[model samples]
Target: MGSSPDIVSPSSRIRRALWPGLWVPVVILLAGSALSFSVAKRVSSQTEALAQQHYHLQHQALVHLVLEHLYRHGNDVSLLKVPLAKAMPQHLSLRIDTLERHTKKPLLQLGSIHAPLARQALRSELDIGGHRSMVTTMPDAQLLKAPAQNLRWLVLVSGMALTLLAFVLSLYLCWRNHQQRKLVQSHRKDLKTQSQKIANLNVEKVALRQALNDSENRSRDLINLSGNLIAELDEQGQIGYISALAADIFKQAPSDLDEKPFQQLVVQVDQRRFVECLEAARADQDITQADLALAADDSEQPVPVTLRLKALTDPVRGLVGFRLSAQIKTRPHD
Candidate 1:
């Protein structure tokens, strides 16, 4: 059989296979990771800059205080020693030197005799009592080290939190997408079923209309061929339709009898019996038969007719009228 040509093609099989909807989540995770890294880097740089600025300001403030002391006391190292020791942390060192302003000659030195290395120290220039002085402050490396480590840990935590949030959001989106796809599929299936039912109903309607038309044509042909008068009456006992033979029986045009009460055509003596038959047909929704004399305008004598009255019903309007089939009776004279 040559394996029936593999029934389903490889391409179609691949298309029917489940596709992992994880791509959206993967992209979101990658973007979130990149954003976290950028933010951490920026924040770290800012933290470092802030720390350096704080150190520079601290150095400036200390130098300014030392100059103020020099200005008030005039080279009195004794007044500054106690306050400097109390103000400066143990890991910091300060140096001050008084020089002649014009010549820049060293006149006096206080605190550290040897200047610390430039990398570990901050220096400032000041003027006190008409002499130029230099102030050097060296802050401890440990002062910035601890806070930097804490900031790094904080950045790491924030990045992790952001990554977790992104992951959760992606999962929710995937779930919602899956649910929406299912709902759409269900609605499509329902629509397909409804469409099929509507198509079936349309087919049935076409068949019924054709059948009704055929039936009506046959009934009309039969009425035309019969040697009798056929009439349709409304609920009020008024003639609605009469066959062509009505003109011969009533001695008037068929159109003239339309909307005329049936009692008008009945002889005065037979009117009560005709009315009773109509009432019986209406009350029971059944057929009732009666013999009645129909008065014709052209003859002095009345024509005898056997009337079959049946209730007329409509699918939507219920009992609408009655159908009367009348067979003419031959008289002895005729």
Candidate 2:
């Protein structure tokens, strides 16, 4: 039988066999890529968080550094000794400059918080006229402002790039996994089809063998039926089969006399004449009949039998078996 195209195709078999190895690695690669992307996003988030935290700490430190600088310069300026309580214009100017210098690029980029509070605190300490006068005194204020502004843009750009890279990696992994899943599905379908075909072939093989065996059994039964009989021949030229009816009259089983030469099994039967008739029947492809008497092996009386013999041919074996039937003659004296 010709196999279906799919079954005979090499590419289809290779697809089935390669699925496990090929697809597993693709799945692993997709998973790894996804995990790495997740980690990168987290790390980028952490970087932004750390940048914010650094801004908070630096803001506090800048305030404290300005306060300390003012205290140390107490003798140089009139309001320095009472700088926290008095309107010290010089100290306000120094504090702003200190803040500008102390804050790093990242802290500056994060920008200031509590701006209103810082100004209020400064106003509370200094007179409004002093604050106005000192605003122009801090050169570092402009220096801090420029770097801080630039740092914000730098951090934002870096974060955006990191986030974009993560998203790209995630998309790549997702697409890779989709391809692998499709391949695996194809392999599974192929395996299912092959398994079904194998099951059908197995069933067909079993059915054929069973049919062959049944035919042989019937033939054997027919052969056995044809061969199960005994025959006899007499001096007048006759040939015949021993029959079940004869065996019953003689009080013996029919099988015991089967296949025995007529002369050997039937005494008072002419052996030569019977052999001649058997051969003639075989040659002519015909049947013959006889009337004879045969002594039971252990008895003196001769039992009369009418016999019939039919030549048989076995087409399969190209040989002959014989068909025989007989009936015994009942006498009043028996």
Candidate 3:
């Protein structure tokens, strides 16, 4: 029987994918580091190597000059050595390990060598060979590597600048996040303040409505307590509101007379008096009096009443309406 293939779990596959993806960035970072290191090493090598030709030519010139000086001195070795050692460049160390042809003496060594010296770019030998061999060696390292040091300083400065730039970006993002939070908090506070104000205004509106209702009820009670008929009229001399006693005097339901003309309740002969009383109230008279006969539609005889009218004026609109109080009069004599 064939073995079944292994089934990978969903979570295992997801974890595998994520872990491998993480390595992509890691590999890129490693590549970048390796590239930087390679470039730095290349810069150092180039700095050391660029001037090799120049140094070689300079070395050849010095050798030729030394030979020329010796020939001019007629091969007097002691006379030639003193001035040559004094005229040598301060930055270089020169050594000649050779024997003279006839005297068999070892040649001169110039410049001090306190440390072990391994780096030497050029080595040569004089034609004073066969019996005596002359060797010359020069190290071309000291001031030639100054360019490499300057390159190192440039790398360090660039790294420091990039680090400072990253630090400043982090601070700016943090400050921006902080400012956004503060702005959100400010908006929330403003909304809360607006909501509180709206709630207070609603409370005030309810209080005003309750106060108006109370005042109307108090006025109704005062009129009922006076044992008289009272009616409130609009600017058109229409009954806007009336006491319950008005139903008894008008011989009709208060609802029936509501918004109906006041002239409808007066006798035909005295209906002119209704117009006169309304006009007097609109004229800003304090209190006006009239004698009128009140008769409803089905009444056979009219009842005589003394009607007193008062103006209801508004500051901006002048006279808006009137208030009428009626008292029924008894028959004077038999």
Candidate 4:
């Protein structure tokens, strides 16, 4: 009965058992941490290099087509023939800048795509058509932000190491299973934080995409509905694209008026004045208005009208054309 005074408590027995069990897990965690870190570092470099090369080849082709188009035909509406942006509207974004200080607007901006994290924007500069312009090509962000090829394996190994570590701790601390609860709670908190961040990013992307689409649609619809006849004149002041309103005003199909000198519509008395206006607008890159008599034919009386002209400058070529808006003059009847 004297030796029974030295009996061990339940807590002491649990503690003694837990300490001996932890050595194996501790060794495993150390080895897993060191090996995983080394592998991840090597894999990250190779992944980034491969991604860069893949993206380079994909976007370089687009840039080549863009520069070639500009070389063959100076910046004009004919860019529609290239059809790069039209084919994969989501995958490619193209921006062409003449780098001309006189004009602030870009020659063409075909798409809107955000660059992914940790990737450099793809840009190239070339002398095309005797003007130095820059072409920036953006690839689909989905490709850039895709998870690395071997990332899943690394995650699985790390998760296994952590799970074993947590298990050993739970066995080591047997007081109401305190260590296990702590590990589970920490993991849940981290999971919630990551989920919240991803949800927020998705919301922002949707809002921005929707806003851009709405803005583009509004601008296109407004241009078509504005009653005034809108036409783009080439370097020679020949109509390139005249709106459908041209049919009513000129009594000729818009296609029939293509390549016709813009001043040809004016009466004989105003031909010199139109030429003068062209020169002045080209020189100043300004808005100019003139009251002119437009004769569709001698069979019909000449219709008086006001012509508005604005210089359409190209990046490399100075005054490449003019954007003309013709408004039919309305007489106030007494």
List, residue by residue over 1-334, the lDDT tens digit for candidate 4: 3647579889887865564446555666666676666676667567667776877876787777776676666755256445766544455566677775667676777766655333456888877556777777676655553445456367557766776676566556543454666667798999899899889988988998898899867755675687666788998999998887766666799899999998898889999988988988888889998888776655566777788899988788777899988777753222
Collision pairs in model 1:
none
User: How would you encode candidate 2's per-residue C-alpha lDDT over 116-201 as one tens digit per residue?
Assistant: 22422321122232321121112222333334445555655555565556556665666666678887889999999999999999
Q: Candidate 4 — what's its lDDT?
A: 0.72
Candidate order by lDDT, highest to lowest?
1, 4, 3, 2
Candidate ranking under TM-score, highest first, comes to: 1, 3, 4, 2
Model 4: per-residue Cα lDDT at residue 193: 94
Candidate 2 local distance difference test against the native: 0.49
Q: State the TM-score for model 4.
A: 0.38
Q: Model 2 RMSD to the real structure?
A: 15.2
Per-prediction backbone clash count: 0, 6, 0, 0
Alpha-carbon deviation at 238 in model 2, angstroms: 17
RMSD each, Å: 8.0, 15.2, 11.5, 49.5
TM-score of each: 0.62, 0.32, 0.54, 0.38
Give the per-residue lDDT digits (tens) of candidate 3, residues 252-292.
78888889988888889999987898887777568898998
Winner by TM-score: 1
TM-score of 2: 0.32
Candidate 4 or 2, higher lDDT: 4
